[model samples]
Target: MALFSFYNVRKPRQYNHTPIYWDPRKEALEERIRKNKRELGMEEPLEDYKPQIKGTFVEGTSHLKRSYNRGEDTRARKYKTFKFLLWLVVLGVIFWILFFK
Candidate 1:
């Protein structure tokens, strides 16, 4: 009987990578040149307009909206609270009967 299993074990693969050189000063200089050309009317400005994508988290998840809409009406809120409490009492009684009695 084999105390240890070598069939499931394998050597990790070697990774060979060549690092690329980057110059932040050169990149900044290129950006500054583009901005100067745009300011001087030598190059047309690139339209980088982004549309607004804003929405309330409450609106996105409708459970909040449902509760909020119901809350605006006093009668609806009372009825919902009453219904929840009634269910809670009923479940409590059932649990008590099963476990204690």
Candidate 2:
């Protein structure tokens, strides 16, 4: 019976061989391209191939909605009208109390 001792913990053994990294998808794509070239009777290209960029206009969530009219904002105009009417009513009440009373 051991006292004041923790569970058995040992250092993992290190390996001598270097790890080989491989991508199956990339290999398959390259193989398919090579097969296509062979079928087309085209020579295998040593340089990188740059595909033509086709730009498509797609409306995304980040894109903002466009407004045609620059000067007229309906919400702001309504807010200003409401604010002016409220101030006019308040001033009229104050005037009636001071002079009429």
Candidate 3:
């Protein structure tokens, strides 16, 4: 019986069939920017318009404080859950040793 094959004569096949994708949102955004550039100095940016930032990491008001309080609450809850599970495991071991041993 042969232990190993020391040579191969076959070559790998080449692939050049990559597909291109179209994005509707990006197209719309580009159109809007072009329109804005064409209408330059004709309109002023809206005073009430604000770029929205998502999640809890923000400045000002009771929102930031509330987020911090929520974080602390979750941390405390997780610690309490871990402690409860640890006790449950310890109790299971103690009961197994006392009755099954």
lDDT winner among the candidates? Answer: 1
Better of 2 and 3 by TM-score: 3
- Residue-level lDDT tens digits of model 1 in 1-101: 87778897767999998659888899999999999999998987675222223336557777767876656455777888999999999999999999999
Instruction: Show where candidate 2 strays beyond 4 Å.
Output: 1-72
Clash pairs, candidate 2, are none
Winner by TM-score: 3
Can you write out model 3's per-residue Cα lDDT over 1-101, one digit (the tens) per residue? 66666685456898888659888899999889866965684454553244444433444557556656577556776797899999999999999999999
Residue pairs in candidate 3 whose N, alpha carbon or C atoms collide under 3 angstroms:
none
TM-score of each: 0.32, 0.30, 0.35
Candidate 3 regions off by >4 Å? 1-72
Candidate 1: stretches off by over 4 Å: 1-72
Question: Against the hidden true structure, what lDDT does model 1 obtain?
Answer: 0.79
56, model 2: CA deviation in Å?
30
Residue 60's lDDT within candidate 3 is 51
